[model samples]
Structures are given as C-alpha cells and as structure tokens.
Target: MSHDSPLQDLDLAAGFLEPPPRRDTYAGWQRWRAGRGHFAPAPRLTLGQWRALSPRERSLYDLHRTATHVNLPLQETPMSLKVSRLVNRRIRNNALKTRPSTRAGVMVTGWGYQGKTETVCEVAAAFEDAWLAMHHHLHPQPTPGTRDVHAPVAYAQTPVTAKPKSTCQAILGFFGAETKRLTLPELIRQLAASLDDHGTKALILDDITRLRMHRADDQDTLDLIRAFMSMNVTLILVGVDILGSGLLRQGHFDEHTRQWVLPPSQHARVHGLEATQTERRFDLVELDRFRYTTPGQITAFHDHLAGLEANLRLLKAPPGMLTGGRMPEYLMRRTDGVVGLLERLIEDGCQEAMDSGKETLDEDLLDDVVLSLDDPERDALAGEVPAIPGSSRTRTTAAPRPACARGRGRNTVFDDHGPRGQAHG
Candidate 1:
C-alpha cells in the first residue's frame, strides 16, 4: 500500500494565526486594530533541541518561523515616534473642539519605502484603540445609524483614476455604503452622514499623491477634499513626494516653523457646493530614512539593529549577529538606511540562512543576495554618491554578487552613500 503524501500528512494550518487584514474598509480596519501587534515571535531552539524534533514537527516549526518572520513587528524609530506624537496630538485636539470650526489637517510626504503608510496607520490605530476604550466601546456621539459599524477611524485609499464622485465613493465604501447608481450629491450626503453617524475623529486618505492637478477631474477632487474638512474629521493624508505632487498648489514654506502653508483660495465654488472651509491648511511632515552620521545617529541605528537581532529565530544566531562590527555597516550600504528595504534584505537573508543550513546572517551570505541597487545600469543612474558625514573614506573592495542575481530597479535615483535631505521630485 502507498504511504500518505508527506505534504498532506503535515497540517500546515494548525498553529498559524489569522493573517492581518487590510485597513481600507470598516470591517478590515476593525480586524486590523484588534490584531495589531498580537503576533508572537517564533520560539528559538538549540541545535540539539532542533535535532530532537521529529521530521513533521521540524517542518511545522519551519513554516511557523517563516510566518513570524514575515509578520515581524515594525520597529519604532525616531521618525515614527515623532510622526505618531504629532498625529495623535492633532487628533486629540480636534476631538475636543466644542466650537464649530474646521480642524487643521496634516499631510505626510516622503520618499517611497520609508514606512510613511505604516507609521501613520499605526498612529491612527492606536488613537482609535484609546478612543474606544475611553468610551467603553460605545459610540461617544451615536446617531440613528442603520449599520452597527462604529468606525472612529476611517482609512481609505485614493482611487487610481480618481474623480470627485469616485473619491466620495471611496470614503463611503469604507462604511459599507452602496454607491451604485448614486448621484454626486447623494454620495456626498451619504459620506457626510456616515462620517457624522460613526463619530469618526480621523480619516486617513493614503496615496494622496495619486491626484494630478493638471486634470480637471483631479482638481475637482482636491476641492472635494478641502470641503471634507468641514465634516469635523481630522484628515491625515499620507503619500510619497506629495509636496512636489502639485497637491499643495501655491503653498510657501515658513522658515520659522518649517511648515508648508497653503492659503485660502479666492476662486468660486465647484459643483455649486459651498466649501466654506476654504483655508487648505495642512502641516506637512516627513518620515525620513535612517542616517549614519553623528554619534546619536549611530547609536540609534545600532539600537534598531539590536532589536531586529533579538527578534530573529535562527538556531545558530550569535548574540550580535546583526549589530556586530561589519554587519551593521554592510546593511547600511546595501539598503541606504531605508527601513522597508532593510527589512526586506534581512527577511531574505534569514530565509537563505535557514535553507542553506547556515542558521546565521553574515556579510558573505548577504553579498550573494542582490537588491534593487545591484544592477550596474541602476547604480550608474543613481548619480554621484555623497560622502558620509564626519568621514572621508570610500568603499574599496566589493563582494562579488551571484551570477544570476540581477536586481529589479525601482527607486534608483537615491544614492546609497549617505542620507539625502530632499527626495528627487
């Protein structure tokens, strides 16, 4: 008789937790908030202990470890902490306004893969958690709403081909409102009603840079966003390179406060909708990448590395595997201090280590793993490297990459030598 398939014999789903849900809708946002930061790290095992496990048990443990690695908690950095404090303060201040006035909103602009979306989402989720607990899990100001969805924090993405009506529908979609055959006026009314009924204190519109002002539809969509301020919700717009995206048309930076300020428009209303809250004011913030310059900067980067090293589940991982002498510098060079890229590199490196039986991360092993910057053409396009601050040295010997390891280039314009004050528009 044929034995059962090994894959079928092992229960892959036995110990896995429900995966984290997207935060784009009411249901998803609630599920995400409840499950945020709930993942436990994979158990570390000694080589002897690993060897003691049965074949099926080892396979299950390996799969569980992979899941834990993929779902590693986002490390708290200086930039992320500052963003959270500022965003939470704004939300708290907006919620306490007894007077009828439009709350000042915030716009977060940064380069791609700098954790802008994750940082803002974390802040919003934390705020919602506190707000709900304060109200004893009841809507503080409940309207006669049909659905029982008490969404205090609404998160929606800007549509790819966004128009005024479609933008309204996007927010309404978060509340599970039916948008089919709905007119623009009906859509706005529904959105406004939902926002009021659900007691939403903050509305996060991600990928706000998707709107191009050159198009009439996009310009109208911007006006609609301005009008949304009067609905008594603090708007948090997160995007990449939003300052240069023409979203803040005619905004000037104040040298004293260092904020890009947008004055009220003097134009007539669009769609005959009176956008009384015409002052398009937003405090532009950026979640910057890591820098390797000063003593404080070096300490911060080392602390970050130490945190990651502690979370790793490799059986043979040494105490300072990630934070040791050359590993940190090598990682900095490979990722250019970007958090997302660094995480991806470490994740891939860990997978390689486990598969190759090395069970540890190092320079030689990481050298074989190519990143988006590995392509020679992409490296050339990345322009001249800026010398590291407080040092005047250059890389001499380069580790040879694998033969078939040509990287896929995306953000090749940012040089990897040092931190840049501004992203290329």
Candidate 2:
C-alpha cells in the first residue's frame, strides 16, 4: 500500500488475462487449440511440381486415378497459392506494424463446388501454420519474432441468415463456443474476449455471401462486420460470385462490378482501386474456369491433363497418350474452360471406366459421359438477351470462370423440359 506502488504504473495485459467466454470453457479452448498439431508445411511436390512430373514408364498398375480424383481439390491450385501468399502478407504486415492502416479484406467468390471452400481452407491453414512455425522454432534462447507469436487464424461459416447476432455467433462457433442459446449481448462480449484471448489477427468467413441481406438484420450484420474490422480483425469473405447488400453503400446488385452498390452511386470496387479505398471493398480474388485460349494456356491445359492421365488406372494408348491427342482441345470446347466441369467430366468418366470393368477411359466412354452431363441452366443463361437501346450495361457472364469459374453445371432436363436432348443435353 505504498504511495506510487508498482501496480499504479502497470497496465494489465487484457489479452493475456481475460477469462474464456461465458459459454466457452478452458476445455473448449484446448480443444480448438489442438487443431494446431495436425498441420504440415507446404508440400514438396507443389502443384507446379506435379505438373512438371511426367515419365515415359508405361503401366496401369502404378496409377491411382480414384485417389487423384478424390484429392484434386486437396492439391494446391495456383489460385490457392495466391490466396495463401495474400493472407500471409496481410498477417505479417499487420503484426509488425507500429501504426497499421486499415486491415485489407478479401472477397473470394466462385460458383458452388468450384473450389472456393478448398481455397479458403488452404489460406486459413497456411495462416495458422505461420504461427505454428513461429511457436515451434528450435532455438532455446528467447528470440525476437518467434517469442510473441500466437496463432489466431479462425475459419467460420457465415450463418444462413444474415443477422448480426447470427454472424457474431458464427465467429464464436469457430472458437468452440455454444452460440445458439446465448443472448446477443453475451455473444458480442464473449466474441471480443475470445478474439483478445487468442490475439486473433484474421478471420476467414466461408460462405460469406450468406451474410448478404435485405432486411433490418442487414444493418445489424453490417455493423457487426464493421466492428470486427475496427478491432483490427482482417476479414476474408468467401462465397458465391455475387455478394449481396449490407456491404455496399448503395445496396444495389451490379453484375459487372460483382459487388453490392453503395448510395448516391458512390460504389466500392473489389479490384483495381487506389490504396485510399482499401476499406470500401475487399481485395477481390475471383476464381473462374481454366480456358485453353492461348498457346501457353493450351500447353498448361495439356500439362494438367497429362498429370491426371498419369494417375489413370487403365492404359489404352501409350503413356501420356491423352496429351498427344486432340482430347484436351475437345475438352476445353465441351467444358467451356470450366475447371469444375472438366473435373466432373473426368470423375464421371473415371467412374464409368471402373464400373464397365474396362479400367480405361476410352473416347466412347468419355463421349457418353459428356453427352449425359450436359446442362440446361447453362444453355438458358447462354442464349441471347434482347438488346435494349441506350443501356450500355452489357452483362458479360464469364467466358465461365473468373470463380469467374461459373459451372460444373447441374444435369437439368433439356430444353422444353424435353427428353434429355442430346444436343447440349
């Protein structure tokens, strides 16, 4: 009780001492933190290395086609690499800054099953691993950067309903809280505390388009999201190509910008904006189909096919015969350069090969599968739109990707809901 005691001059470390959220216990903290143990570093055979791997050895016994099909998305894509690099740079910059500017947010949008989730998961894992690496650094002596490192990367799916309370609850769910029964005030308080407890730097919100809104909850969710950003939480929203209202100032949906509109025509640009407008729209990373439009593109396309064929179970032609054939060209044409569609076609073809006891995806089997897999919705979207005079807004559906990767389109009944028409069935 001395005058000017040491306690008088000490600022308590709230992040270090804060108790767990009301609904979350120390057990939950350990459970969630246990996830850190499972991650492995970047693979030795990176996707590029996979593409580069090609040998002339001829044998169906060595290939693992089924495994390849299952693990296609698990293997890193260029898009995934780009996303990881972006997340790492964002976290590293923010962590090291003395007076950081607004955290950079990113919106990764694509059609469903077009690898959005996988890409986001990769980014989240990569972010989490950085801290893991920092924590497990070898030297026994106290180190500068590694000592204070704490892993705070959280991945949570946005709720189906775009309410602020729901969104808050979702963020809390990732940290292992029981969110459903908690009151909104309790949710927010616990959420902030958890963020502090983990020293969270980034939160990857998957299926973020679900956060889109049209009701009063719109403002609520928007405010909540804004509050997270204000807390120095870098938010990455992953979802469908179109992000709905609440994020936009105007609240209108625009096809070209691929962002919600803001008020009085003041808008946010997801990509290509100046540094000053960083807060308005996220850094846009759009994933779309892989087209074989250029010579280099075609070679890369062939390389991709070659990699897949390398793993195919049955060998009908010479090893890597698919690469030499005009099949890749035909594939690009049929698939319209949609990677998901292409993969689906390959997957179905592989299944047919296995089912028919032929172990080989011959041209006829691929042909039958392609005919059966053609989509109706894509046809409808592709058909002509009557041009309106004086409206310069030409809606350009991605040459189907961009997450501009727009399809692995569903098998709807053919036109007129007719008996599966073979013509682009």
lDDT values, one for every candidate: 0.74, 0.51
Task: Please report how far candidate 1 places residue 296 from its true position, in Å.
Answer: 1.0
Can you tell me which runs of candidate 2 are displaced by over 4 Å? 1-65, 73-84, 98-101, 137-151, 243-246, 249-281, 315-317, 370-425
Worst 10 residues of 1 by lDDT: 383-392
Q: What TM-score, over all chains together, does every model reach?
A: 0.82, 0.60
Question: What is the TM-score (0 to 1) of candidate 1?
Answer: 0.82
**Candidate closest to the true structure, highest lDDT:** 1
- Residues 159-200 of candidate 1 have per-residue lDDT tens digits of 876897889988988988899999887787778788988898
Model 2 Cα displacement at 68 (Å)? Answer: 4.3
